[model samples]
Target: MAITLSERAADHVARFIEKRGKGVGIRLGVKTSGCSGMAYKLEFADEAAPEDIIFECRGVKVLVDPKSLPYMDGTELDFVREGLNEGFKFKNPNVKDECGCGESFNV
Candidate 1:
């Protein structure tokens, strides 16, 4: 099980961490919300928890809690800019269905 960051995403995250001056990496997880039952959560990790499952992608660490691993396995994160708006996108293989608005998913 692994979560990878595209080159653009890795560079984006690395820039943020550099600006913040304290983050060791980024954390990825799932939460029980949104219309489709689950949603993605992200945060800057100052340090890795002992039990976290870590994957290295493009020189950045992508940290995942063991519980969130199943849902996020084989997911690739990408950073994109579409005209005026830009943000992180999740390409998750485990997603069976997603809300029409693209905010949530169910396995």
Candidate 2:
């Protein structure tokens, strides 16, 4: 039961945290939206909730709510740059299928 971050992702997140100057870490979760019924949500966490589970990867902290863990366990978050397009990508072993737009998935 854990989430991981690629080195590039950790570097990117660390830089963002440094620029913003006030964040405990990044939070990762799932929300009910998009065509596939679930979409990944990522945000900066100023602090962890009492019920949140934390993972340390690449020297960066990753926070997750207890409820979101089942859906995101063993997920690896990666930062990618492809020409003019770049963003965070999820390599989720639990994902059964994903929407054509690549914005959502179902497990």
Candidate 3:
């Protein structure tokens, strides 16, 4: 029923929004693609649609469409670093399996 972001992810998103100079929040969704059939979609949203379900965490906002909510419920978005590589990671409780390349998942 809800999505949250890690502190690090919030900080990273806030910094990016600040640098970009204009953004309402990050939009999270899922689309049909990749081997597992559903791939995560992310983007900086300058405005929210009327149907979006918004979640606030660490002073940052995440917007999700109602249609995508069921697949992503109880997901926590996080930013992480590993040596020279760093990126956003998803800790999704509903994900029963993920593609080998980590690009897609299925509940």
The true-versus-predicted C-alpha distance at residue 102 of model 2, in Å, is: 0.7
User: Candidate 1 clashing pairs?
Assistant: none
Candidate No. with top lDDT: 3
Q: List, residue by residue over 1-107, the lDDT tens digit for candidate 2.
A: 99999999999999999999999899999999999999999999999999999999988999999999999999999999999999999999999999999999999
* Model 3 regions lying over 4 Å from their true place: none
Off by over 4 Å in 1: none
Candidate 3 on 1-107: residue-level lDDT in tens?
A: 89999999999999999999999999999999999989999999999999999999999999999999999999999999999999999999999999999999999
Runs of candidate 2 with Cα error greater than 4 angstroms are none
lDDT of 1 by residue, 7-68 (tens): 99999999999999998899999999999999999999999999999899999999999999
Q: Per the 3 Å backbone cut-off, how many clashing residue pairs does candidate 3 have?
A: 0
lDDT, model 1, position 34 = 94
* Pairs with steric clashes in candidate 3: none
Which is better, 2 or 3, measured by lDDT?
A: 3
* Stretch of 10 with least lDDT, candidate 1: 1-10
| TM-score (C-alpha, index-matched) for candidate 3 | 0.98
